[model samples]
Target: MPAAFPSSDPAIPTAPLTAEMRDALRAIVGEKGLIEDEHGKRPFVTDWRGLLVGGAGAVVRPGSTEEVAKVVRLCHQHGIAIVPQGGNTGLMGGATPWPAHTGIVLSLGRMNRVLDVDPVGYTMTVEAGCVLQTLQETASRHDRFLPLSLGAQGSCMIGGNLSTNAGGVQVLRYGNARNLVLGLEVVLPSGEVWDGLRALKKDNTGYDLKHLFMGAEGTLGIITKAVLKLWPAPKDVCTAWLAIRDPRAALEILSEAHSASEDNVGSCELMSRAAVDMVLRHIPGTQDPLKADTPWYLLLEWSSARARQDGAEGMSEKMEQFLADQLEAGRVLDAVIAQTGNQSRNMWRIRESVAEASRAEGPGMSFDISVAISSIPEFIARGLEAALDILPTIRPYPLGHIGDGNLHFSFMGPSGMDQQTLAQYKGAITRAVNDLVTSLGGSISAEHGIGIDKLDELSHYRSKTELDIMRTIKRALDPQNIMNPGKVLRL
Candidate 1:
């Protein structure tokens, strides 16, 4: 194991599962619901990155909220730890257990069920384990739209999305996962269900407890169900790929885009030529939408609910005029509007495939950081300079949701450099990048929560008063520290 990941924490219970405990777990979840063999438990303990592999006593799949409560109660009674999982698709090691864990991996996969869809109210109540793509499709069938979307949506569950407070491309318009949720039902550390699953637009109840579990990353409680807010389905839409002059030009174009697009901008993604090429190299059948000499590129999208008429001007016409003006003004070097659905899909495929391509290419590090929208260009420029100053050979492949100011600052290892060699420079590079971010008043973590990967980073950057409040809440809810111990906080 890496030195950063320790097998045990003093506050967390590490009692091994004995025969009686195993029997009790099996009895609660039944034989079909339990996986005791190593082969069966491997995937649950392994993180999405395939690094940070941990250990679990057994894997438990509960079919309903009641069953989940019982399993949690049983574990609580025995003073055993519990790691709640939705899809096991998290980039951070939030769902993975510790190597010394004697706890059960409680997966909510079988509890996936769309409880209700209220089109009139623009709300959908669903079990947490429902796949994000499935929920999108369900909402689409009702002529409503679920705005939460990402590269992992095909496999990632809604519960994990909410737990991480995921930010996707649509966040430029609709906002993050937490913004889309109206209420949530969570199972506390004590196995008590806190039912806040109401479809109300206005609820000023005490504390607004649902917000606590949404971004807690399973450290406070397990999100079992949620009432999701929806939007009207988009009709006329336009997607254009532009090779911009630079990051500053990209921001200027985006600033003018809102008024040009009539405030219908859906997404504005900033991509470097290196990141685009990396995606095309690894993701099969993905074709480059446009090729230009500029290093910076922008994928701009606009959508409106009103359908295009026979001859009336629509999103495409407006976007075409905007691009022409930008090109004349020197902000855009070259551009191409996706003329077909396949072309538009190709553009999205390149953007979304960046993550999968990075994984396949091997031995790389990425930081999901954010700053003020205006500070993004300056941050990126200085951020890259600081990193290259440390190691010039470190290949930079930066990309981002420029409209929202979240950048996935990433880099692959220098050619021919092995994992061990790259690991040596990680500490220095991470410190440099994070230090720059802190100095600029930017966040170290943007959409991804402070899971195992950023536990220490959070402590280092956050004020003592903030951390003390968080620790107090964690201890109050889980005095035993049995809820995902040794993952988020040192305690």
Candidate 2:
């Protein structure tokens, strides 16, 4: 059996859910919506990584926005804490409820629905629980594209995407979830529903209220629905794998590609030798794209929505010429360009499989960080050196969207290091890397919000004034702190 929730405060009496409160919630969501059994609640209480296992008073699923609001109102009346959950694919422990705290898991999965799609307006109105991939496919059917692609897109819901302000490989061109949203429908801590789902591109009316809940991580409110921006689907896409001398060379190629391709570069990714090796080792049916092994590799893509003129070259031709120029300039030692759709998918699979492959190899401390594009090479060189200085046997496996300067800088413990030994180095390595990133004017938490994992780090790195402002907003919006308590801000 899973351990009971260990409380920090022993003096305060634990509040069990009363029959009246349960009846009220059940009335709002119906009998099928409320999950009270331990077996039924296990998936919602446990995080994806299995690192965080918590307990929830009950798991409630409300199908509609009205139902969700009513459930929140009932929880508010009863003074019961709420933990809004989405797909439960978050890297940070943002969606999981605290074991020490008593709350109901307010899951948005039942709210999954595509309300409207405006191809001409370039907008898509969707429920927060809509899966990212489903939205992407829906957009594709209308000859449009929702460029928010990620590894967990298959399961991660849009609500969690909005709450976390997630960033994916296409962030280099399309921006993060915060940029794609035009409006939001949120359930405030007071059980008040704030409906701001406008598809308009320009609305210069007062402060944009939607921004408040975009990356608030469920601390401010529960995101139930949203108005998302869409783009014309690309007609032509070119994917290429290049073996570069180092990170600096990859950056150089990125600069040249933009100029040569007339800024059609859709994605630019950097992968280390170790990261590639990890993928080939753990992932089946995957072969190295290039014969010669280099210290680093770059996965570059160029895409165009417009069709090619009758006698003109297309994106593929342009990418080929760009790669030729780089090879001649010694920036790219070797390269391979995908000639078919299957080939392109295969190439992307290698890049997307990095996380899974790394996990299969061993436990490691991972960081999602970003610095100025110009300082990426410096940050990688100095940060890796600093980490190696601390523990010489450490394996640095850093990879990410280089165009935006966000790197999933992760380090695998030395071979045969037990879990206990690995835990000892996590803190020191994280601090050393974070210090280097901060000194170079970078953010410690780039795409991933500060869940429980980085709460203390945020307190340490963020300025007192900045922290005070965050707290002030939290207090004004969620004075009761009943919404996802102990997340984003410490009480």
Candidate 3:
């Protein structure tokens, strides 16, 4: 039986969990699955960055999809809100609950399991709770690769990745998490399970509901499982680090390289000298890539399945010649091509370690924005120049998948500044940078989803027409406005 609400007060009731709700929920999931104490529920209630804090009546860990459906149905009956959580590695506070008093934290971490691997079909059926790194390893066991590589692969779950449509290093080649998904198993707000877990490469079904849920950030429904596309592991790969003169030169080089080899090119990442300095100063075992100093650097990679270099057509040698020509043409300042596998790994490590290095450097606001590939050079120059005018000491670490035009533009406060003072300037820096990005017709958020962090910015960026469409869809899907109440588009 559902708990009866107080007729007198409209605000969330302060009443404890009813006996009926507790017993019924425990019956569906064993005692081991329910987390009622503060200690046991601590991890699931907070996000990865500790930016948002939330409270929950209880944290329920369902063991199966069926159990998830049952829990949703029960919560709906009792007017209790449910916040679905996976590995809790989200940067935007999507998995974390709002400060509401009526929601329950529903964790999918216990439901992790690789359901099936179809090597012939080149697909893998996995539960939403499966860790991305483990899934990659499982695919590798079958001589295939799940190419959605990211920093949080070891801790971020596939469900959260799909929810955010996460883009990582390989996004330049494989696209975002949405691109890698074939199908999904979703539990709707009404407790109905929509199972679309078919592993077909071509399925032109009506509406394509999977995509709606892909980057929805769990605003529409809770994802229970997914069918992910896989690729045959590359037989040969070459990774190299090049020192470039400027962002304009980097963009030019990327255009030239992509013209030389189409999809064979894997990743093209940009890191400014200022960004590299933070990595070297904060991250131990980090080294400069080039022997000579340059304004910026680029990390480029090539992937091929065939081991043959075609006698006269050596990929590495050809790439070397291309760089040499560019250097002679005065487009490239300097370059260091990785000759061995260890060297390649070491070079990539520096790129991956930029975020941690920034934190150690100081407190600052982070912006993951995208602009036209051709317009990035101007955007960076203009944005950095404007921000520096406000605080001349502000150091901008503008780096990321420049091949795709997505840049992680970060601001580090002046030297020896206290955390309190740095915190005060976050909004001014964010607004200034965002305004510049918007003026250039760039997306405010390229990869990260709009959780609570960017709700206001989303409104400013989206026009009246687009905002109306999003609101209509939200009202139609969640009429009661209970599913992730304050997310993406405001309610």
Candidate of highest lDDT? 1
Which pairs clash (backbone N, Cα, C closer than 3 Å) in model 1? none
Once fitted onto the true fold, the runs of candidate 2 whose alpha carbons sit more than 4 angstroms away are 1-15
> What is the model-wide C-alpha lDDT for candidate 1?
0.90
- For candidate 1, the per-residue lDDT at 273 reads 98
Tens digit per residue, CA lDDT, model 1, 72-145: 88888878899989888887788888778888889999989999999999999999899999999999999999
Query: What are the candidates' C-alpha RMSDs?
Result: 1.4, 2.3, 4.8
lDDT of each: 0.90, 0.87, 0.81
Pick the winner on TM-score between candidates 2 and 3.
Answer: 2
Which of the two, 2 or 3, has more lDDT? 2
**Candidate 2 residue lDDT tens string, 1-491:** 22222223222112557888889889989999999999999999887766678778899999999998898888777678888999999977889887765769999998889999999999999998999999999999999999999888989999999999999999989899999999889999888999898887899999999999988999999999999999999988889999998999988999988888788899999998898889999999777887666789999999999888777899878988888888889999999999888788878888988877876887677899999999999999998998998989989899999999999998888999865677777778889999998999999999988877787788889999999999899889877677888777775
TM-score of each: 0.98, 0.96, 0.93
Candidate 1 local Cα displacement, residue 79, angstroms? 1.0
The TM-score leader among the candidates is 1
Candidate order, lDDT descending:
1, 2, 3
Least well predicted 10-residue stretch by lDDT in candidate 3: 1-10
